[model samples]
Target: MNKDDAELARFNALARDFWDPKGPMKPLHMLNPLRIDWIENQYGSLVDAEVLDIGCGGGLAAEAMAARGAVVTGLDGADKLLKAAQLHADDHQIQVDYQLGMAEDWAAANPGRYELVTCLEMLEHVPDPESVIAAISHALAPGGTAVLSTLNRTARGFLLGIVAAEYLLKWVEPGTHTYRKFIKPSELAEMCRRHGLEIKAVTGVRLNPLRALQPQPFELTQNDLAVNYFMSVRKPL
Candidate 1:
């Protein structure tokens, strides 16, 4: 289990608005559908699949999976965020097992239990991303897919993802991302490689703020990974 105290505290402070589409998590709300579409495209249906969502703040992605017939378990290191997630899940009458724990610890306790593991936008925040991915590998069922998303470490990432997002436009909460912790696609693939997982697909995520219809319009791009991107990794059978 790798917990970043400051990051935990930051999310805890914003727990109350974690589910609010117009609030601190608005960007995620906008990005969720695109994310789900991309993941489902790669892995197909989630019907009746056992899913583990690490760093699942406020249950956005977890609820989406559950709605698509996935038996989901949401995990987070922050107690406050977990409480908010539970409350929101109950409010929506969606069944999700919300737990407070680190990714490494939870994976150790529940090995080979999930057909799908999602650690989106969280690897950078964790103090030890390698440990978390290793745990995910151990926890995942053979041939199961692991979906991960994070910012690439590049000038474009620092410019668009961080500077423009956090300081310039304030689309996300300020200080949401740390440049030093950002991981490029190659680095992430290597992490998965070390855990015996094979990279299946790599897709970048782009957000256009200047669009008139929406402040944040996101799309998946194949040739561009200097900003946000998602990768699907598969464990050999």
Candidate 2:
């Protein structure tokens, strides 16, 4: 497995409560709508699109894509998280093909297989993020769009993304992220370019402290890329 075992173990422990709104996965739940909407805006309608979500922990993003009429496949390395995702899908009657595996292997087997590829919040946890980007490039068909989100490697990112989010606010688990693994936007863009993908858009994500009491608190912007951000890329047609 080309994964960090310790990181996988930490996420596995949250499988049981992955879907709870007030639980440790609250940030994901809150940001999901924005993510989905942004994806749709970048790739147009997901209806009938072949979508693959790499590192689809607990299937939050997978289930959402399915609900939007896309044929969704979710790939993850965590067995317990996959089980929780399966159980949740069964309960909701959502048709998401959840698989347990690594993105590189899956990409090798199914090259150019999907119309849209999503690898949100997965890069920072992986052992080699560039390899994952390569896999994403391989799995996407000509003109296909790939969307990714991650924290930037910066002091602001550490202050807000890790310290405030993990320690002060208690928004996510304490060890949810490591500052060193966070990839800067320029580095991410360069990686995507090397993999034959064109950058379409970039957006910064920020949580509104005033909306802390609300179900959704995060917003996407064009100005700030110092911390958490999203990038959209497309394979050449």
TM-score of each: 0.97, 0.98
Residue pairs clashing, model 1: none
Q: Give the TM-score of candidate 1.
A: 0.97
Model 1, range 33-131, lDDT digits (tens) per residue? 989887788788999989999999888999999989899999998899989989988988999999988888888899998899999989999888999
The stretch of ten residues in a row with the least summed lDDT in candidate 2 is: 207-216
Q: Give the worst 10-residue stretch by lDDT in candidate 1.
A: 207-216
Q: Per model, state how many residue pairs clash.
A: 0, 0
Residue 26 displacement in candidate 2 (angstroms): 0.6
The sequence of per-residue lDDT tens digits that candidate 2 reaches over residues 56-110 is 9999999999999999999999999999999999999999999999999999999
- Cα error, candidate 1, residue 193 (Å): 0.6
Best TM-score goes to which candidate? 2
After superposition, the stretches of candidate 1 with alpha carbons farther than 4 Å from their true spots are: 209-216
